[model samples]
Target chain A: MVIDLDRCTGCEACVVACHSENNIGMSTPEEAARGRVNHWIRIDRYYEGQFPDIKVKYRPVLCQHCDEAPCEPVCPVNATYHNPEGLNVQVYNRCVGTFYCANNCPYTVRSFNWFDPKWPEPMQLQHNPDVSIRPGGVMEKCTFCIQRIKRVEDQADAAGRPVADGEVQPACVQSCPAEAMIFGDLNDPDSKVSRLAGDGRATKLMEELGTKPKVVYLEKAR
Target chain B: MKHLFLLLLSVALVVPCLRADQPILFPHSTHINKVHLKCIDCHISADTRDAATIPGVRKCMLCHAKIAADKPEIKKLAAIAASGREIPWQRVYGFEKAAAVKFRHGPHARHKVACATCHGDMPNAITAQPLVKHNMGTCISCHRQNNASDDCATCHY
Candidate 1:
């Protein structure tokens, strides 16, 4: 996935879309106030310069699907593992809720379900059938929409062809109103994600940490 | 001492056989053998969908309405259908909700696994029974045997 920081307006359509598509529960008033709101994808806002010359930057952060994910090794139950497709996938059932994954994560992308997800009447109807509604006390992070990936792979396999570039799009990528996000097969040189990764402006979060997150961020082009 | 041991052994054998019978008398002996109805005839979505769904009352009525319509069980089914209700069929085989395992019958059926593979031999079953304990190890071993992916994400989302 490639995110162009220059294009983001901080409108947060991607955040709303992620919650809706993934069946993430709305935080209660109490939980929200406690800074315990559950969000798989979030914008990290930072203000640059002093009051007279200040600019706000919004960088969307989620599970990097890191090549050397700190969360994966810390998991005692092996609930979260790096898939062959390079996704850092989490199995909610296997997760024992140690929260060790969340703790070890440099990006702090993993979130724990505090209670059984509650949807107000009609809200339940909006939940996606493909993504399993996570149970309480399970640590869940962004899967980069593994269900969508699998569906595309299944279709490609049935047709005896390789998955096409831009075939799989995570909910957040498709929902970005600014068209700031891009998702594709990073392995393919001609793919948009691969191209963006090689851009001069492209960099990753906390590069010194060497987590090697698949998500590449393009800094604001001033 | 010998008499007590013999009686205890007989009771243990009898108890399991009695308990193994399902609540409903959906005998394969009658449905598959004498009647010769296929599994998919009742399990409508077995070949197509994620779930091998059970037949609704109407499916049962297709044959039961004319054949042995006077039987008490058939009458009950007819009444339920007339009242616009689905049969409260308890799950005979399933993973627990917390296990979060997604088992699609369509893929397994496409792989040419007979219903008896994981479910055990049901050709002579008197009623539905959860004969096989579907755990991760069991699934992984079978996938290994078939050279299928044993990826954690394959079954668990």
Candidate 2:
């Protein structure tokens, strides 16, 4: 996914959409106060220049779905591994709740489920049946909206055609009101994501760390 | 309090037995053999919706309103329809909520898996009963057979 920071207003529509689509349970006020809150796609805001000449910039960060994902190697259960599609797939059932992946991650994007997700009454019915409701004691992170990826993949397979450009839009990309996020097959050179990644302004979140995350962010323009 | 606990425990133990005796004996044989209705006839969304939809009383009434209108079972269907409440049918096959399994019927139906593939010969069944365990292993083995992805996230996202 290529996030054009130039366009992001930090509306957090992507955040809200991810929670609903992925069945991410809510955290109480206490949990949030204790810093146990979960927001898979977080909008990191920073202010540049002091005093009245300040400028606030919002950078939306998610799992880079990195190629050289550090989390993959440390997993004793091989629960977190790189899939053929270059997506960092998390098998919740296989995860033994070891926080090694979270510790090793430079982005610190992965959130451990401190408790089983609870949705009272009709709120439970609002859950998207496509994605599994993650149970407690497992580390959860962004999977590029992998369930959405699988759905498109199955459709493409049935049609006997290559996944077209813009065929797969992760929840963040789909729900972004500002249209800041871009998702496509990176292997396809002609794809928008590839072209955006090739931009001079585009840079990895932590290039020095060498995680090689699939997500790239275009530098905010002056 | 002790008696209450014992009663609750007995009720919990007996619930499965009660479920075995379905509200209505579905008589899959009569529908398939005598009526010549396919499995998808009433379960119209079996190939489309996530779960093969259990037929509402309306779906049953579509045919029963005329054919076998006087049969005791048909009367039950009609009476249930008139009450404006859905049939209280227990689900015979499903993964637990915590298993985090998501099964779609469209892809499976498109793959041309027979009705008996996972469900056994439901047409010959007297009442709804799960033929396969639908465990992770059971699902994985089948995917292996078909050269489909058995990725944990495929079902257990």
lDDT agreement of model 2 with the native: 0.84
Give the Cα-based TM-score of candidate 2 against the true structure: 0.91
Q: What is the TM-score of chain B alone in each candidate?
A: 0.83, 0.82
On DockQ, the leading prediction is 1
On lDDT, the candidate that comes out on top is 2
lDDT of each: 0.83, 0.84
Report the C-alpha lDDT of model 2 over B93-128, residue by residue, as the tens digit: 888776767888878988898778898876666778
What DockQ does every candidate get?
A: 0.51, 0.50
- Give per-residue CA lDDT, model 2, range A1-222, as digits (tens): 899999999999999998888888888888889988887889999999997999899999999888899989999999898877677888887899999999888888999898987766778889887887788898898988887887887788778787889988888899998899999888889999999999988988987888888888998446
Error of 1 at A200 (Å): 3.7
- lDDT per residue as tens, model 1, A1-30: 999999998988989988888888878888
Clashing pairs in 1: none
Q: In terms of docking quality, how is candidate 2 classified?
A: medium
Q: Cα miss at B101, model 1 (Å)?
A: 1.6
Task: Name the weakest run of 10 consecutive residues (lDDT summed) in model 2 chain A.
Answer: A116-125
Interface RMSD for model 1 amounts to 1.4
